[model samples]
Target: MFMSRLRRRMGRLAAGVLALAALEGTCTALAQQMPAMPVTVANPVSRKITESIEFTGRFQAWPQVNITSRVTGYLDKSSFVEGSLVKEGDVLFSIDPRPFQAAVDQAAAQVKITQTRIDLTKANLARAEALKKTGNVTDATYQANLQAYQEAAASIDSASAALATAKLDLNYATITAPISGRITRQLVSRGNLVVANSTSPLVSIVAVDPIYFYFDLDEASYLAYQRASKRKMDAGDAEPALKAEIGLSDEKALSHQGTLDYLAPQVDAQTGTVTARAKVANADGFLTSGLFGRIRITIGEPYEALVVPDVAVGQSSQGRYVIVVGADKIANIRPVELGPKFGSFRVIKSGLKPEDQVLINGQMRARPGGEVVPQPTKLDVPETLVPDPN
Candidate 1:
């Protein structure tokens, strides 16, 4: 009975070991047959992009004027309200005209007195000429009469000049705006004495519309712009107008467009930079002088380039990179050199080919060497890109 029990126990132990081996083999097969993680991929989109450089800049009023008194007098009244927009030629301030008008009247009376003196001198000279011709007058007497007539004529000319000057002084008493712009507060109050040719300004005005923008470009950027301009002219095209885009500090992108109208005659030796200026229309008067902003200027012509959406580009310890799926359906991280942004897409300066498949979605499931099932799709690019106000 003891020998039979031992034989049954041995048989049961062998069967249990064989069942465990079959179960392990079945799990290995199931793992091998599993499908790859699905991911969305697209080829780099071809687009026309231009190379550009950006700089920090500020907005300035195109023409700013300081209002001052041309003639000395007491301030009579002001025609404009403080902090108001004034039209060109609108009256701004009025100096006391009573004093200037009185001076003009005095000058006019002096001119009349000189005219009366000239008549008397003419009559005496004529009588002297007749008496001399008849030998009734002495030669010395006739000579004196002639000299008197000449002196009277000269006196009248002097008096006439004084009258003209007085009239000009009278007109200057009424000050007018030299330009259309917003004016500052009056520095001198009514009934206060104001002096002529004073360094102090009574008020200030700044033209806000069609504002000017000033920026400095590095030496390298200046040279590149010159080269690109020359190439454009050589191609029988108009010299490429150096255009600029501007953005305020709060803005995300440059949107306001302007033309680079003026460049400094020479570069600054100390700064090693060239000064550039641009003009932008500000009819709404939103942009103001002394406001700091960013500016961007294109230095190259448009050319075909490979681009990918900004979100697809990733940052890592190595640098900027993108995940590219190869022919073997394996995801590989590619390090790429990046260029300026072109709308929502980023310009890939290098390390990307137009034919390479880039994974755009399901990045979390992707590993550097992991296999993936890529879903091919077309990249939709906008027909027109809105101007970026730098």
Candidate 2:
């Protein structure tokens, strides 16, 4: 009797537990089908956004000059130090001037001799003219004396010009910098003989105050920008005007500054691209010549732009689209015309409006035209952006 009672009590307790568990599962299932899945979105409006054309170019000095020696002689001394800034007319090197100095002296002596001869010839011509009047000399003799004096005067002038030429040649032996700039090291050392008008250069000078950055644009990009501009102008946007800025690859931007200084008149037939140039200041000497530089050119004005996260945009054979949330909590797959991409955002040129909210999270599993419960989530994190390495 006791064993039967214990077994019957245990069986009753187990049956009650099973019934409660089944009721709880049924209630949980009903709750899950009640609340809707959530998503996030953002607002769009008019912003001063920039569109940039990317190109890989290099930095070059504005003025580069190769210093060459104009006189033939052994270099006696280098006046200016290597890699030093020099002014125009600053003596860069001194050549052995003993030979040139002797040559100048010889030219001067020749001029003096020619002048003495001219004086003597003039005296003889005067005496001959007097004798001709007195009938003591023939006309031919007087004429010959006159010619001799004129020839002597001509010889003096020629000698003076020769002296000046010799002095100039002597000055050339001391090679001075032609431009005010930073000059490279002496190509030939002291006691090394450099010839005049030779192939070798004695040094080089480069101006570094304001540097130039050059880049290229292919024909396709050029034409595409033109076509897009025409369409924009037709659609009531202003005429096609482009601007630009500069940035280091490792930095956001050196500054929000730069200008479109140059554009090629004709396209390069070989590469089918147009060359462009930008001038940037380097006052602190931070920028070095021949360093790699980036040139960014923005082509057009900022519009009343609609933007969405790049991840939210899905592409297909039809076109790019996004699962957009419209009025009455309805979800719709809307096709959009996309403009240039700026960072992580895509500019929507058409289709979606400013009020349209785009679904970012839980978008892949969401069904179109279904009820969307927008759950605004904060995505600000400590490591959202990873900066590029230097």
Candidate 3:
């Protein structure tokens, strides 16, 4: 009975070991035949990318003018509608002209009186000369008549100068726009007494077309731009005009194109930055002065760069990375150094090549070192995706 029990136990142990071995073999075969994770893949795009820098700026009118009273008088009427556009030399306000006109009349009367005196003095001098030649008047008396004639002529000249001054004052009664621009609200209303050349202005005007955009460049950016400019000059190439783009605060993309026109010669001591300006066309009068804007300027020449869809980038403790397919159809994790965004694509500054195939979709299923079934596809880079040229 002891021998029979021992045989049964040995048999059972042997059967269990065989079963375990068979199950292990089946599992290995099944894993080997398993299908790879399906994923969409594309090669990195190669393009000439121009590096750029963005800054906050404000739009300013090309010409700003303050309309002030030239002569003291009561404001009679305003020729322009408040907040309306005005052309150069357009009349804006009218001061009370009666006072200026009365002054002019007084000056004219003085001129007339001086002319009559001159005529009388000339007649007397002529008579004195005739009398003197005929020995009727003394030599001293003739000399006195000549001196009186000269004094009358000098008085006429003074009266004429006074008349001119009066006429100028009359012209000053009409305040006109010095430039073509949009006028601000009337600062001094009609019927208000305005002082001549006062600290307060009657109105303000700002040029609308061809607006100016002003921005500041930090010390580092200014130095970089200077170095780039020097390099271009040293290469015997004509320095290309720097181009810029502008967008209003509410805008998504930079829709306005402009050219960099001015750069301050010295950095601001208080701000540690250099002021720069660009000219932008605003024929439609869409842009207004004092409006905030976002500006981008191309800082360097175009060079070849690698780009990929922004969706392919992943963030982790190791930083940004993308899934790439290897030659053996295995998924590999690649860390990338990212740069500025180009539309829906991200610029890969490093750790990527133009020829490498990257997984665009199904990245979650494609584990590192795992096999993948890549669906080859082409990347569509639209013309709008390209940034504005420098």
Candidate 4:
């Protein structure tokens, strides 16, 4: 009887243990099936994006001038401070005016002397004519007096020319600025002898406002610009004004706006590149001459393009790519060709469609071929991010 009771108890204990094991296995399977990873996704933004090309260039001032003396004399004094701004017609240097002033005064005295002689000659000639009419003077004497009067008049004319020349030389004694600009150091200081029309400059000046930006475009870019210009002309429309943006080497954002003003007529044979120039305003005088700058030119017309937030883009051995969430809630990597960046969004030249949903936030949680619980969200885009049509 005791043996049979012990065997029954063992059988019941085994059945209970088996039931508990089955329940635990079922609970584990259900937990594994539950979704754990959460990710934020959004549809790719569709907009008309302008494509631009970048080039390295330098800033140059317009109307750069080398200031030199027009007349030879000892340097007297300068009206301008070194490296200071000067206005047009402002006297820059005053040469030794004593010599020029003396010449002018001497010429003036000669003119007065000549005028007195002319008066005396007139009086004498009148007397001679009167005597000749009364038959009191011989014909030879009258003719000789007339000849003397003509000679005196000729001398007065010569003195007048000398006076005019002297005044011009006096005016040249004071050197004035031809154009408004920032002047360099005085090459010839006070008390130093300077020669007229010398090759060496006394100072140099460069115009700050409305500066020029020069850059080189390869043959391919030159041809592209020409084609676009030609197309506009053929359509009976005015040539579109090309625009450029510039930033200094130390700057990260392009803040300067400029207009394309010049294009080389021919390409350089040696470099196979053409020179291009843009005019930029420098009202505040922030841009200095010979500054290294980065420039971007809008070379293409606006077109529909897919753009994703810069955070959405990733990189690997396969280059740049983005994660897109499909209808099955699975993350897939889409390789893309990138163009210029527009604000916080990067222009995807390819590998993305307008309706495609891309993973924006929680990128780490999302992996290729992996399931995700996608939460739809909106992207923050700037209103003025698009390029101006004009």
Q: For candidate 1, lDDT tens digit of each residue in 1-390?
A: 998999999899899889988988998787556668899999998877777788898999969899899999999999999988888999998998998899999999999999998999999999999999899999999999999999999999999999999999999999999999889888888999999989999999999788999999889988998898788788887746778888899998788999887878899999999998889888878888999998888888887778888888999998999999999999999999987776788878899999999998889878788789999998897754443333
**What are the runs in model 3 whose C-alpha is more than 4 Å off?**
1-38, 126-137, 228-241, 268-271, 313-337, 349-353, 362-372, 384-390
- Expressed as tens digits, the lDDT of each residue in 1-390 for candidate 2 is 999999999999999999999999999787557555677865543444545566767777878898877888899999988887788889988889999999899999999999999999999999998898899999999999999999999999899998998899899988888877778887889998888988878889988667777788789767755665677768886644445556666666645255556668989998899887777776655666778766666555445666666777888899999888776777789998887665566667888876777787788556677777876543332222222212
lDDT per model vs. reference: 0.88, 0.75, 0.88, 0.86
Q: Which ten residues in a row are the worst by lDDT in model 3?
A: 381-390
Q: Candidate 4: what lDDT?
A: 0.86
> How many clashing pairs does model 3 include?
0
Report RMSD for candidate 4: 10.6
| Candidate 1, poorest ten consecutive residues by summed lDDT | 381-390
TM-score attained by model 2 = 0.76
* lDDT (10s digit) by residue, model 4, range 53-150: 77889999989999888789999999998988888999999999999999999999999988898898889889999999999999998888898889
Worst 10 residues of 2 by lDDT: 381-390
- Model 2, which residues run further than 4 Å from truth? 1-34, 224-243, 248-271, 360-365, 375-390
- Report the Cα lDDT for residue 383, model 1: 53
Mark the regions of model 1 whose C-alpha exceeds 4 Å error after superposition.
Answer: 1-35, 233-240, 265-272, 311-338, 349-356, 362-371, 385-390
**lDDT tens string, model 3, 1-390?**
999999999999999999999999999888677789799999998767878888898999978888898899999999988888889999889999999999999999999999998999899999999999889999999999999899999999999999999999999999889999899998877899999999899899999988999999999878877777777778786854577889999888888999877889999999999999989999878899999998888877777778899999999998999999988999999999987787788888899888889999998778788899999999986543555322
Clashes of each: 9, 0, 0, 0
All candidates: TM-score: 0.79, 0.76, 0.78, 0.74
